[model samples]
Target: MSINHTLKTQPVTPAHVQQEVKLAQRNLANSTPKENTTPEKGTDVKLSALTQHIKADSPRDIDMERVEKIKDAIRNGELKMDYDKIAQALLQNILDDR
Candidate 1:
C-alpha cells in the first residue's frame, strides 16, 4: 500500500492572513525539528497570541474584554491566581485531554 498527500500550511483567517503568512515565513526561516520548533516564551505560540482582536466591535471580541478584565483585576486587587486552582484546572485538562 502507498499513500501520498501534500499538506500546505495555510493561515486560518483572511483579515490576518498576512500575519500568518509572515509567521509562516519566519517559521520557514527558523525551521527546526517538530519537537524543537517551539523554543521558549518569546519564540513559542502562547495563549495570549490566540487572544487577538479581529473585529473592531468591542462587544464581539470576548478575549479583548477578558484581557482588559485580567489587567483590571491585577490593578484592582480583584484577581487571584491560586496555584491550587491552577493545578486543579491543569489536572482537569489532562483528564479531559484523554
Candidate 2:
C-alpha cells in the first residue's frame, strides 16, 4: 500500500514539496472537475445517440436490512462510526448485501 514519492531519495525541500503538493492538488482538482453538461444533454447534441437510465437501487432486500442493522448499531452504540466512516460503511454494506 506504500506509494513512492519524491522523497525516495533526498529529503523533500520546500520547493520540491511545494511542487509535489501543487501537482497533487492539480491531480485532485482534475479528477472532480464538473462535467460541462448533464448526461441528458448528450443525446440532444448528438455527441451520444443513446442512453440508459441507471437503476439506482439494490436488487436485494439484504441491502436495506444491513442499513437498518448499521443504523441500529449507531443508535444503540454497538459501533461508533464517524461521518466519513459511516458513509463508507453505508456503501460497503450495500455492496456486501448486494
Candidate 3:
C-alpha cells in the first residue's frame, strides 16, 4: 500500500509590506535630532532630606581582611556551607515578600 499527502500554501503579497517599509524610511529620514540637556560645570544640585539622612547613616567601614579570608577558604575548598539554613532563609524571604 502507498500513501500520498498534498500541502497547500498561500502566496505572500509584498505591496503592503513595501508601503510600510517606505513609510518607516521616510519617517526616519524626516526625524529631528534631539538637543543635549546635560548640566554645565559649577551647577548647584540639591538632594532630598531622606537621601541626605541615608547617606549619613550608611556604614563607611569595610572589613577587607575578613572578605579575603572567606575568598581564600572558598578557593581552598575549606568553606563549610549550611545549605539547610540558607534554604530556610530563602524560603522565609519569599514568604515574607508574598
Candidate 4:
C-alpha cells in the first residue's frame, strides 16, 4: 500500500512581509503584563510545616561507619544472604500490593 500527500505553499512578497511585521508589532503593543500574587498566611504556614516534616523524616547524611562495615564484610566473604527471609519479604510485598 502507498499513500500520496500534497502541500500548498504561499509565495511571500514585500507587502506580505510588511503585513506580518505590522501584525507582530500590533500584538506586542496590545500585550499586558500579568499581575503578581502572594500566597495567604495559612498556605505559607502549611507549606513551611510540610517542608520541615520532610526534612525531619528524611536522612540528611549517610552512615559512613555502617557502609564501611558492610564493605568489609563483602571483601572478607562474610556477608551472608538469608534466602528464606528475603523470599518471605518478597512474598509479603507481592501480597501487600493486592
Candidate 5:
C-alpha cells in the first residue's frame, strides 16, 4: 500500500543570497596575494636585536663559566650556605603570596 504525497519544491537560493555570492566572488577576484620579500641586513639586525631582548627575558642561555665556577667552589668546599638569608627570602615569598 502506497500513500500519495505531493513533492514540495522550494527555491534553491533567494535573490539576496545570489547577489551576496557574486559580491564575494568579485572581492576575491579583485584581491591580490601579497608579495613575499627577502629581509635586508638592517631588518635582520633589528630582528636579531629583538631576539636578543627576548632571550634576555628567558633563561635559555646558561652561563657555563659561572656555572663551572660555582661547581668548583662546591667541590672545593668554598661554597658557603646562608641558611638565615634563604629562610628570610622563603618567608618573604610566602607572605607576599598572601
Candidate 6:
C-alpha cells in the first residue's frame, strides 16, 4: 500500500508584506519600555528596606579563602551535596517565580 499527502501553502504577496510591516509598526509603537530600561529624568525611585540594606552591606571583594576552602573540599571528596534536596529547592524556586 502507498500513501500520499499534499500540503497547500500561501505565497507571500506584496499586500501581505505591507500588512505585516504595518502590524510590526503598530506593535512597536504600542509597546511599553521594559522596567530595566533607564528611567526618565525627574522619576522618583524608592528601594525597599531589605534592598537598601543589601546594597549597603554587600561585600566589594570576593572571599577568596571561602572559595578556596570549597574548592579543596570538592577535590578531597569531603563536600557532601544533597543533590535531591538542592534540585527540589531549585524547582520550587522556579515554580514560585511563575
Per-prediction TM-score to the true structure, in the order listed: 0.31, 0.25, 0.49, 0.44, 0.39, 0.38
Q: Of the pair 3 and 6, which is ahead by lDDT? A: 6
Winner by TM-score between candidate 5 and candidate 2: 5
The 10 consecutive residues of candidate 1 with the worst lDDT sum are 48-57
> What is the clash count for each candidate, in the order shown?
0, 0, 0, 0, 0, 0
List ranges where model 2 is wrong by over 4 Å: 1-62, 80-98
1-98 per-residue lDDT for model 3 (tens digits): 43665567788769989899999999997796657958677968899998888778544556878899999999999999999999999999999999
| lDDT per residue as tens, model 6, 1-98 | 43676567887679889999999999997795666778677968899998888778556567989999999999999999999999999999999999
Preferred candidate (lDDT higher): 4 or 6? 6
Off by over 4 Å in 4: 1-51, 56-61
**Model 5: per-residue Cα lDDT over 16-84, one tens digit each:** 999999999999977966579566665434457767787675555778889999999999999999999
Give the RMSD in angstroms, all C-alphas superposed, for model 2.
Answer: 15.3
Instruction: Give the number of the best model, judged by TM-score.
Output: 3
Global fold similarity of model 3 (TM-score) = 0.49
Look at candidate 3 and give me any clashing residue pairs. none
Residue 15, candidate 5: alpha-carbon lDDT: 88
Task: State candidate 4's TM-score.
Answer: 0.44
Off by over 4 Å in 1: 1-59, 76-78
- lDDT of candidate 4? 0.83
RMSD of 4: 11.0
List of clashing residue pairs for candidate 2: none
Computed on alpha carbons, the lDDT of every model, listed in order, comes to 0.77, 0.74, 0.86, 0.83, 0.85, 0.87
Ranking by lDDT: 6, 3, 5, 4, 1, 2
Candidates 2 and 4 compared by lDDT, better number = 4
lDDT of 3 at 6: 55
Residue ranges of candidate 3 with Cα displaced over 4 Å:
1-31, 34-50, 53-61
Please list all clashing residue pairs in model 1, or write none if there are none: none
